[model samples]
Target: MISGDVDAELRRLADDPSFPHRDAARHAIRFRAEGDVSDLVAIEDDPHPCAMTDVVFAMAGSKRTWLNWVPMPAEAICNVANEVGSRRAEGEDLGLVSLALSAAEPASAITASERVMGRVELGIGDFPAPDIRMPLRRGRYAIWRYDGTDPVPAVPAPSGAAIRVLHEVGGEPWSSPLSGYVQAEPLGALPLADLLGLLAHLPGPPDTPRWEYLAKSTPTYWYRLLQPWVCLGILRHAADEPWATSTRREVLLDLALGIEDWTADAALFALVTAAYRESELRAEVHQVVRARLNAAASAPRLVTIEESLAHLMLITPGCTADDRALATAVLARAAEAGEEDEDEQAPPPSKAEKRRWWQRRG
Candidate 1:
């Protein structure tokens, strides 16, 4: 523990140019200090793991950001992807039973429970049968079902692209809100835009919410995409539809909650009709995300994402830089608003002024 009062320590740290202690202090019982006073009030019940993962999520059902973080050491962000793998292996988390089933050859696993119609029959990624409430118990081991109803929580996928990115540019330990949030650097390999595009192509139970996982899963493809702003943007686009239930809407909610990057992969899926890039989208969105990621531990979700995006130097990744550059451009535009140009501010055109102008023109 650092010496001195919390406020005093905060003051000392605030003087530094860069954001530090940002990652190490997330979700702790003891109160911590922050550069922005707003940051302190934003995370009122922070530090406790159970305070609510989605507190960071804009919506009530939004997914967790930490789980699918491309950058290592997500502070205060719940790393559910890592947990799911561990839990599934131990038979602790029932949610992930589907991954194993999907990996297995056909006829390897059997189910006895009644599955909902149009549930697993159609097609898509192998998913869990959340509808199947109970376990398949028998002789030696209990047989779990994979009806493909539920979605898997993505941590960070370690594909060649990701490894290449990390290996090249590399990452620096992040600035987080959690204490002892650990330190690591980015292997600064610029991310490719088209990772997990398959999410778009997957056919699912039409009647049931096609994009239900957007609201169901704790850490979904949304926040993992690292573009909550994109969700808000798309939500604005579909606000008029009212009853429109496209996968796009579901995808937007995930984006808002930080499950998936809306711009890079999500938007591309809709525009180009691709799914193979969905995971790649998850992987690539990080570029824009890191651009906006503030001290994950300190600022409110809004502020953190904004600040992080604001400080980014270069964003060469999957999606266009419109939203990425939007922050500063907006601010610049706002600043220029009040100042009137001398030419425009000239006295109202009177008879004399008009005559002078006319004479000059002649």
Candidate 2:
């Protein structure tokens, strides 16, 4: 049974005419009933093409069912390829293309793979099929090939050609946002003190709506700035220090709460790392994060928030019970709203049909 808080949230979501959270809420409800989010895969059949790309990335990251991601539907793959093609043609960055190529089995997306390969071949003068070599249990490693072949023994690392392709298309322009700041120093480096100073000076909690702050600044600037710290263990290092000041913690927490859309991953990384070092801060961080997620659950673009949550669960597998519960509750609200919408739109079934549906399950 759904908890009272979750049920009330669902009711509020359902009654809202804007219906921003419809899809996510519905998926949540189904997840609660089925006990597995993957059970809602059928929802992908008619998803927005761009949203489907995000779904593909999310499913790939989910180690529990990564193998099943190979044979995605052809139409969906085509849509993603077309998006890549259009973006490439317009001279836009091909970061998404690189991700698609990395995650998809070339055989499963034969035609789309060919198109991407054609671009790489033309750009780099080679047909190197990039492979992601992942280490497995017991001193084993699995090499995933674009051609969908069985895993092979890890041998020589990926070729320079493949690495070049990844370099050219793998990341966004601001992948390292701190470069400019660090480079400005005479030594072309930023000390930890300076880095902390820069972070503290970033936009703080505002009296205006959070979205207004987001709109005024580049959406990903803060996340990009914080990512390096998260990756280099700087955030963790700071949290572990007994002398760490409240100023540092407050700056980090404010940034964490300010996160929305794609920046959620960075926030999760920072917050989770901080919480891991300071156990006392865990509950407070969870509360703040849950509130942020609840507010975003009703936004028009949920893919960013969804992907953020998925990445958080993926990285901190052992600490996700609370997050999972919160996710289920939010999704359940979406699901209930979906049912109401469907009920309003769908024609009433005959008594015989309803009886037959129930009888079939028995």
Candidate 3:
């Protein structure tokens, strides 16, 4: 039978008495929609979310949406920039990674981003050194959260603090331990599940998937990753386990951020980014930067990092306000040390040389 016959049969089975028939029909429509996402996208403006969700799963789970969305629109619009009719207006979730990355406008768009988001924006730059970096450092998305019943005492204001405390809560029983670090003012604690529930609906890939996209640039990179399967003769395992677990993937990303190597370290630093709240792995992070800078070829970059490292270190959580103040002092001392070196290197003016030079100037 032709495609029309199959389509008709599927519609009939959608409400069929057979248990397997209805389920089969459901999967069939999804697979078919995934292959022709434009058909679904055309109706995205429809208010029927139940009908829309099926399309979302198909597009996210299959190649049809990701592989074909661009060409379909370009042919219709002549230029996607000049025309506004495409799915760009729909705001319907398609779960396409490239769409999200491109929607964020990746590079030039990030300069306008304010803190937390700002640091992450820097990570997308072409190359790091010699590029003018912004002075407005990013902030963490995670605000300081605390639990306690009694009111907590105020902590001293941060002198040269890196982490900008956006909001805070205290006065519950658990406030004592949390109060010392943050320059925390008081508020009521948000319910734990409510807080996480709010976060779960936010767009953007979980950390690992985003990193994987960045680390491997294109289809060729993905194919190369598959070479291990070809060599191992374990095609079944490779097919079954493509993505890393959430925990492992997040750790890899933190490791990537903490360490200064990898091909695009400069690029990563250029993006405005927000990590999980109160997260800092600075010692491990700086060590990676230090090691990279010490490499024979990267001397100038090292010098630049040495100049900037203290400031960057404080911005991550786990660093104290005292640590931040100390870093500021150390930078000042480094400047003084340079002046002393200049004085020490200069030759003492001999009496005869000083007189001759003065006379010539007059």
Candidate achieving the largest lDDT: 2
**Predicted structure 3, TM vs. truth:** 0.20
Clashes within 3 Å, all models in order: 66, 7, 31
- Against the reference, the lDDT scores of all candidates come to 0.26, 0.35, 0.26
What lDDT, from 0 to 1, does candidate 2 have?
0.35
Q: Across residues 127-198, which tens digit of lDDT does each residue of candidate 3 receive? A: 334221211122222111112211111222222111111111111111111111121221112222222222
**Rank by TM-score (best first):** 2, 1, 3
lDDT of 1: 0.26
| Model 1 CA deviation exceeding 4 Å by range | 1-8, 11-159, 167-173, 176-191, 194-362
lDDT for each residue of candidate 1 in 186-304, tens digit (9 for 90 to 100): 21112221122212211111222322332233222223332222222232333344323544444432332232122222232222111111233433344434332322212222121
Per-residue lDDT over 1-362 for candidate 2, one digit per residue giving the tens place of the 0 to 100 score: 11245544544554667865455445534543444424233233224524433233233222221111111122223444545545664567755322222132212133223333232221111222222112111121111232233222122443333323222221222211122112222211223343333222222122234423432332222223333232222343343445246433544454444423122334445554444334566666556555555555543322223434533442332335666776766556545744664666454653222211211010
Q: Please, what is the TM-score per model?
A: 0.22, 0.32, 0.20
Between candidates 1 and 2, the lDDT winner: 2
Candidate 3: regions farther than 4 A off: 1-272, 276-304, 341-362
Model 2 C-alpha RMSD to native: 23.1
